[model samples]
Target: DAGVTQSPTHLIKTRGQQVTLRCSPISGHKSVSWYQQVLGQGPQFIFQYYEKEERGRGNFPDRFSARQFPNYSSELNVNALLLGDSALYLCASSLEQPRGNTIYFGEGSWLTVV
Candidate 1:
Protein backbone atom coordinates (compact mmCIF):
# COMPACT_ATOMS: atom_id res chain seq x y z
CA ASP A 1 0.00 0.00 0.00
CA ALA A 2 1.14 3.52 -0.63
CA GLY A 3 2.30 5.41 2.44
CA VAL A 4 0.96 8.74 3.58
CA THR A 5 1.81 11.49 1.10
CA GLN A 6 1.76 15.32 0.97
CA SER A 7 2.06 17.81 -1.86
CA PRO A 8 4.15 20.91 -2.35
CA THR A 9 7.01 19.54 -0.25
CA HIS A 10 8.04 23.16 0.27
CA LEU A 11 6.38 26.54 -0.06
CA ILE A 12 7.00 30.23 0.50
CA LYS A 13 4.42 32.81 1.49
CA THR A 14 4.17 36.31 2.84
CA ARG A 15 2.63 37.46 6.05
CA GLY A 16 -1.16 37.75 5.98
CA GLN A 17 -1.52 35.37 3.07
CA GLN A 18 -3.38 32.08 3.01
CA VAL A 19 -2.05 28.62 2.26
CA THR A 20 -3.64 25.26 1.71
CA LEU A 21 -1.77 22.00 2.18
CA ARG A 22 -2.90 18.59 1.03
CA CYS A 23 -2.47 15.12 2.47
CA SER A 24 -3.43 11.64 1.38
CA PRO A 25 -3.40 8.83 3.87
CA ILE A 26 -2.27 5.29 3.35
CA SER A 27 -4.53 2.83 1.64
CA GLY A 28 -7.29 1.25 3.75
CA HIS A 29 -6.75 3.81 6.49
CA LYS A 30 -9.75 5.48 8.09
CA SER A 31 -8.09 8.04 10.30
CA VAL A 32 -6.09 11.06 9.22
CA SER A 33 -4.28 13.57 11.43
CA TRP A 34 -2.57 16.90 10.92
CA TYR A 35 0.28 18.37 12.91
CA GLN A 36 2.52 21.43 12.93
CA GLN A 37 6.18 21.39 13.89
CA VAL A 38 7.78 24.75 14.44
CA LEU A 39 11.53 25.07 14.53
CA GLY A 40 13.01 23.36 17.60
CA GLN A 41 9.64 22.12 18.73
CA GLY A 42 7.74 18.87 18.67
CA PRO A 43 4.89 18.39 16.26
CA GLN A 44 1.72 19.87 17.73
CA PHE A 45 -1.51 18.12 16.92
CA ILE A 46 -3.78 20.24 14.74
CA PHE A 47 -6.62 17.95 13.91
CA GLN A 48 -7.60 14.30 13.70
CA TYR A 49 -10.48 13.01 11.67
CA TYR A 50 -11.90 9.51 11.56
CA GLU A 51 -14.76 8.35 9.41
CA LYS A 52 -14.94 11.87 8.00
CA GLU A 53 -15.66 13.37 11.42
CA GLU A 54 -13.46 15.34 13.70
CA ARG A 55 -11.94 13.19 16.44
CA GLY A 56 -9.39 15.55 18.03
CA ARG A 57 -8.15 19.10 17.93
CA GLY A 58 -5.15 21.03 19.20
CA ASN A 59 -4.59 24.41 20.87
CA PHE A 60 -4.46 26.47 17.77
CA PRO A 61 -6.36 29.53 16.68
CA ASP A 62 -9.18 29.62 14.17
CA ARG A 63 -6.62 30.55 11.55
CA PHE A 64 -5.87 26.87 11.37
CA SER A 65 -8.50 24.52 10.08
CA ALA A 66 -8.76 21.15 8.37
CA ARG A 67 -11.18 18.62 7.03
CA GLN A 68 -11.17 15.00 5.91
CA PHE A 69 -12.90 13.57 2.89
CA PRO A 70 -14.92 10.45 2.39
CA ASN A 71 -11.93 8.74 0.87
CA TYR A 72 -9.98 9.44 4.08
CA SER A 73 -7.77 12.09 2.57
CA SER A 74 -7.41 15.48 4.29
CA GLU A 75 -6.48 19.11 3.72
CA LEU A 76 -5.14 21.76 6.07
CA ASN A 77 -5.73 25.47 5.59
CA VAL A 78 -4.04 28.36 7.28
CA ASN A 79 -5.24 31.93 7.00
CA ALA A 80 -3.41 35.19 7.60
CA LEU A 81 -0.15 33.32 7.65
CA LEU A 82 2.55 34.79 9.80
CA LEU A 83 6.26 34.33 9.93
CA GLY A 84 5.66 32.32 13.08
CA ASP A 85 3.53 29.96 11.02
CA SER A 86 6.49 28.92 8.94
CA ALA A 87 7.19 25.30 9.79
CA LEU A 88 6.72 21.76 8.68
CA TYR A 89 3.18 20.48 8.35
CA LEU A 90 2.88 16.74 8.68
CA CYS A 91 0.06 14.31 8.06
CA ALA A 92 -0.43 10.99 9.76
CA SER A 93 -2.79 8.08 9.55
CA SER A 94 -3.82 5.18 11.74
CA LEU A 95 -6.12 2.18 11.75
CA GLU A 96 -8.44 3.78 14.33
CA GLN A 97 -7.37 1.21 16.89
CA PRO A 98 -7.14 2.74 20.32
CA ARG A 99 -4.76 0.07 21.54
CA GLY A 100 -2.52 0.18 18.50
CA ASN A 101 -1.97 3.84 17.88
CA THR A 102 0.59 3.58 15.15
CA ILE A 103 0.48 6.72 13.03
CA TYR A 104 2.58 6.94 9.90
CA PHE A 105 3.85 10.39 8.93
CA GLY A 106 4.53 11.84 5.51
CA GLU A 107 7.70 13.65 4.46
CA GLY A 108 5.85 16.88 5.33
CA SER A 109 5.05 20.22 3.69
CA TRP A 110 7.47 22.95 4.51
CA LEU A 111 6.00 26.46 4.67
CA THR A 112 8.02 29.61 4.89
CA VAL A 113 6.62 33.09 5.51
CA VAL A 114 8.34 36.39 5.14
Candidate 2:
Protein backbone atom coordinates (compact mmCIF):
# COMPACT_ATOMS: atom_id res chain seq x y z
CA ASP A 1 0.00 0.00 0.00
CA ALA A 2 1.09 3.60 -0.64
CA GLY A 3 1.35 6.40 1.86
CA VAL A 4 -0.98 9.35 1.80
CA THR A 5 0.35 11.79 -0.78
CA GLN A 6 -0.32 15.47 -0.11
CA SER A 7 -1.18 17.87 -2.88
CA PRO A 8 0.54 21.25 -2.88
CA THR A 9 3.20 19.17 -1.10
CA HIS A 10 5.04 22.32 -0.30
CA LEU A 11 3.26 25.43 0.81
CA ILE A 12 4.47 28.95 1.31
CA LYS A 13 1.84 31.51 2.16
CA THR A 14 1.58 34.74 4.09
CA ARG A 15 -1.32 36.48 2.34
CA GLY A 16 -3.84 34.72 4.60
CA GLN A 17 -5.26 32.89 1.61
CA GLN A 18 -7.13 29.65 1.96
CA VAL A 19 -4.90 26.59 1.58
CA THR A 20 -6.38 23.20 0.85
CA LEU A 21 -4.44 20.00 1.48
CA ARG A 22 -5.11 16.82 -0.48
CA CYS A 23 -4.15 13.34 0.68
CA SER A 24 -4.77 10.05 -1.13
CA PRO A 25 -4.97 6.48 0.11
CA ILE A 26 -4.57 3.23 -1.80
CA SER A 27 -7.48 1.58 -3.57
CA GLY A 28 -9.81 -0.71 -1.53
CA HIS A 29 -8.78 1.18 1.57
CA LYS A 30 -11.55 3.23 3.13
CA SER A 31 -9.77 4.91 6.07
CA VAL A 32 -6.43 6.67 5.76
CA SER A 33 -3.60 7.94 7.91
CA TRP A 34 -0.16 9.52 7.60
CA TYR A 35 2.68 10.99 9.63
CA GLN A 36 5.92 12.92 9.31
CA GLN A 37 9.21 11.09 9.51
CA VAL A 38 11.59 12.68 11.96
CA LEU A 39 13.88 14.21 9.33
CA GLY A 40 12.24 12.93 6.20
CA GLN A 41 9.39 13.87 3.90
CA GLY A 42 6.11 15.65 4.42
CA PRO A 43 4.07 12.71 5.74
CA GLN A 44 4.39 8.96 5.46
CA PHE A 45 1.71 6.29 5.51
CA ILE A 46 1.15 4.64 8.87
CA PHE A 47 -2.07 2.67 8.51
CA GLN A 48 -5.73 2.83 7.63
CA TYR A 49 -8.79 2.53 9.83
CA TYR A 50 -11.70 0.67 8.29
CA GLU A 51 -15.03 0.16 9.92
CA LYS A 52 -13.65 1.66 13.11
CA GLU A 53 -10.97 -1.02 13.14
CA GLU A 54 -7.31 -0.82 12.23
CA ARG A 55 -6.53 -1.94 8.71
CA GLY A 56 -3.53 -1.98 6.37
CA ARG A 57 -0.13 -1.15 7.81
CA GLY A 58 2.94 0.37 6.21
CA ASN A 59 6.60 -0.60 6.02
CA PHE A 60 7.16 0.01 9.68
CA PRO A 61 8.55 -2.91 11.65
CA ASP A 62 6.84 -4.85 14.43
CA ARG A 63 8.07 -2.24 16.87
CA PHE A 64 5.27 0.13 15.84
CA SER A 65 1.56 0.01 16.49
CA ALA A 66 -1.34 2.47 16.70
CA ARG A 67 -4.16 2.48 19.22
CA GLN A 68 -7.49 4.20 18.74
CA PHE A 69 -9.51 5.22 21.76
CA PRO A 70 -13.19 5.70 22.46
CA ASN A 71 -12.74 9.47 22.57
CA TYR A 72 -11.86 9.33 18.85
CA SER A 73 -8.22 9.88 19.68
CA SER A 74 -5.44 7.60 18.51
CA GLU A 75 -1.90 7.09 19.71
CA LEU A 76 1.12 5.68 17.93
CA ASN A 77 3.30 3.61 20.18
CA VAL A 78 6.91 2.71 19.58
CA ASN A 79 8.67 0.32 21.88
CA ALA A 80 12.39 0.54 22.64
CA LEU A 81 13.08 3.94 21.13
CA LEU A 82 15.74 4.13 18.49
CA LEU A 83 17.21 6.97 16.44
CA GLY A 84 15.44 5.61 13.36
CA ASP A 85 12.09 5.53 15.13
CA SER A 86 11.90 9.27 15.69
CA ALA A 87 9.00 10.98 13.94
CA LEU A 88 5.99 13.27 14.26
CA TYR A 89 2.85 11.14 14.28
CA LEU A 90 -0.37 12.56 12.84
CA CYS A 91 -3.73 11.11 11.88
CA ALA A 92 -6.86 11.72 9.82
CA SER A 93 -10.37 10.39 10.42
CA SER A 94 -13.25 10.51 7.96
CA LEU A 95 -15.86 8.33 6.36
CA GLU A 96 -15.10 10.22 3.19
CA GLN A 97 -11.40 9.46 3.04
CA PRO A 98 -10.86 10.54 -0.53
CA ARG A 99 -11.42 14.25 -0.16
CA GLY A 100 -8.45 16.06 1.26
CA ASN A 101 -10.58 19.08 2.04
CA THR A 102 -12.18 17.22 4.92
CA ILE A 103 -8.83 15.96 6.08
CA TYR A 104 -7.73 17.77 9.19
CA PHE A 105 -4.27 17.28 10.67
CA GLY A 106 -3.76 17.60 14.39
CA GLU A 107 -0.87 19.06 16.32
CA GLY A 108 1.09 15.82 16.19
CA SER A 109 3.25 14.33 18.88
CA TRP A 110 6.96 14.26 18.15
CA LEU A 111 9.23 11.41 19.17
CA THR A 112 12.95 11.98 19.22
CA VAL A 113 15.16 9.06 20.05
CA VAL A 114 18.51 9.86 21.56
Candidate 3:
Protein backbone atom coordinates (compact mmCIF):
# COMPACT_ATOMS: atom_id res chain seq x y z
CA ASP A 1 0.00 0.00 0.00
CA ALA A 2 1.18 3.49 -0.78
CA GLY A 3 2.01 6.02 1.90
CA VAL A 4 0.83 9.61 1.82
CA THR A 5 1.06 11.22 -1.64
CA GLN A 6 1.31 14.89 -2.58
CA SER A 7 0.89 16.64 -5.91
CA PRO A 8 2.98 19.22 -7.77
CA THR A 9 6.38 18.35 -6.34
CA HIS A 10 7.41 21.99 -6.77
CA LEU A 11 5.80 25.36 -7.34
CA ILE A 12 6.86 28.99 -7.75
CA LYS A 13 4.62 31.96 -7.13
CA THR A 14 4.74 35.69 -6.65
CA ARG A 15 3.68 37.60 -3.59
CA GLY A 16 -0.12 38.00 -3.31
CA GLN A 17 -0.77 34.90 -5.36
CA GLN A 18 -2.45 31.75 -4.07
CA VAL A 19 -1.47 28.06 -4.02
CA THR A 20 -3.17 24.79 -3.30
CA LEU A 21 -1.57 21.49 -2.38
CA ARG A 22 -3.25 18.13 -2.37
CA CYS A 23 -2.72 14.89 -0.48
CA SER A 24 -4.01 11.35 -0.33
CA PRO A 25 -3.65 9.23 2.76
CA ILE A 26 -2.78 5.59 2.98
CA SER A 27 -5.59 3.08 2.95
CA GLY A 28 -7.58 2.78 6.18
CA HIS A 29 -6.22 6.05 7.54
CA LYS A 30 -8.75 8.59 8.79
CA SER A 31 -6.66 11.58 9.71
CA VAL A 32 -4.60 14.07 7.74
CA SER A 33 -2.42 16.93 8.88
CA TRP A 34 -0.59 19.73 7.13
CA TYR A 35 2.70 21.33 8.07
CA GLN A 36 5.03 24.01 6.80
CA GLN A 37 8.80 23.72 7.01
CA VAL A 38 11.07 26.69 6.49
CA LEU A 39 14.77 26.37 5.88
CA GLY A 40 16.69 25.74 9.13
CA GLN A 41 13.46 25.37 11.08
CA GLY A 42 11.36 22.44 12.15
CA PRO A 43 7.95 21.87 10.64
CA GLN A 44 5.04 23.92 12.00
CA PHE A 45 1.69 22.26 12.19
CA ILE A 46 -0.93 24.01 10.10
CA PHE A 47 -4.03 21.92 10.44
CA GLN A 48 -5.32 18.48 11.27
CA TYR A 49 -8.53 16.84 10.08
CA TYR A 50 -10.08 13.63 11.20
CA GLU A 51 -13.15 12.01 9.70
CA LYS A 52 -13.66 15.13 7.62
CA GLU A 53 -13.72 17.46 10.64
CA GLU A 54 -11.03 19.81 11.78
CA ARG A 55 -9.52 18.60 15.02
CA GLY A 56 -6.51 20.84 15.44
CA ARG A 57 -4.96 24.02 14.09
CA GLY A 58 -1.66 25.77 14.62
CA ASN A 59 -0.59 29.40 14.75
CA PHE A 60 -1.13 30.37 11.14
CA PRO A 61 -2.85 33.27 9.50
CA ASP A 62 -6.36 33.01 8.19
CA ARG A 63 -4.96 32.70 4.71
CA PHE A 64 -4.23 29.06 5.42
CA SER A 65 -7.11 26.65 5.14
CA ALA A 66 -7.65 22.94 4.62
CA ARG A 67 -10.35 20.32 4.20
CA GLN A 68 -10.58 16.58 4.24
CA PHE A 69 -12.95 14.64 2.08
CA PRO A 70 -14.97 11.59 2.96
CA ASN A 71 -12.34 9.41 1.40
CA TYR A 72 -9.76 10.91 3.80
CA SER A 73 -7.86 12.85 1.13
CA SER A 74 -7.10 16.48 1.91
CA GLU A 75 -6.16 19.80 0.33
CA LEU A 76 -4.24 22.71 1.83
CA ASN A 77 -4.76 26.20 0.45
CA VAL A 78 -2.79 29.33 1.09
CA ASN A 79 -3.94 32.72 -0.12
CA ALA A 80 -2.11 36.01 -0.46
CA LEU A 81 1.21 34.23 -0.62
CA LEU A 82 4.17 36.12 0.75
CA LEU A 83 7.89 35.65 0.41
CA GLY A 84 7.77 34.52 4.01
CA ASP A 85 5.39 31.77 2.95
CA SER A 86 8.01 30.10 0.83
CA ALA A 87 8.62 26.71 2.33
CA LEU A 88 7.97 23.01 2.00
CA TYR A 89 4.32 22.05 2.54
CA LEU A 90 4.11 18.61 4.03
CA CYS A 91 1.10 16.31 4.41
CA ALA A 92 0.97 13.60 7.02
CA SER A 93 -1.52 10.83 7.65
CA SER A 94 -2.36 8.46 10.46
CA LEU A 95 -5.09 6.21 11.70
CA GLU A 96 -6.16 8.48 14.59
CA GLN A 97 -4.86 11.19 16.88
CA PRO A 98 -1.32 12.06 16.00
CA ARG A 99 -0.18 11.79 19.60
CA GLY A 100 0.29 8.05 19.47
CA ASN A 101 -0.48 7.00 15.91
CA THR A 102 2.27 6.35 13.42
CA ILE A 103 2.17 9.40 11.19
CA TYR A 104 3.40 9.12 7.61
CA PHE A 105 4.63 12.08 5.61
CA GLY A 106 4.69 12.82 1.91
CA GLU A 107 7.65 14.07 -0.09
CA GLY A 108 6.24 17.61 0.35
CA SER A 109 5.38 20.40 -2.06
CA TRP A 110 8.09 22.98 -2.40
CA LEU A 111 6.69 26.50 -2.81
CA THR A 112 8.76 29.57 -3.45
CA VAL A 113 7.28 33.04 -3.40
CA VAL A 114 9.26 35.86 -4.91
Candidate 1 lDDT, 1-114, residue by residue in tens? 789999989999999999999999989889998999998999998998999998888999999999998998999999999889999999999888323789999999999999
Q: State each model's CA lDDT, in order.
A: 0.92, 0.52, 0.95
What's the residue-level lDDT of 55 in candidate 3? 97
Considering only N, C-alpha and C atoms within 3 Å, which residue pairs clash in candidate 2? none
Name the better of 2 and 3 by TM-score: 3
List ranges where model 2 is wrong by over 4 Å: 1-34, 98-101
Question: For candidate 3, lDDT tens digit of each residue in 1-114?
Answer: 898999989999999999999999989999999999998999999999999999999999999999999999999999999999999999999988798879999999999999
Predicted structure with the largest lDDT when compared to the true one: 3
Highest-scoring model, TM-score: 3
Look at candidate 1 and tell me the lDDT of residue 58.
93
TM-score of 1: 0.95
lDDT of 2: 0.52
Off by over 4 Å in 1: 97-99
- Write the residue-wise lDDT of candidate 2 on 1-114 in tens digits: 444443534433333222233344333344556565566577787766554467667887666666544433444555555556555666565545435535555445454445
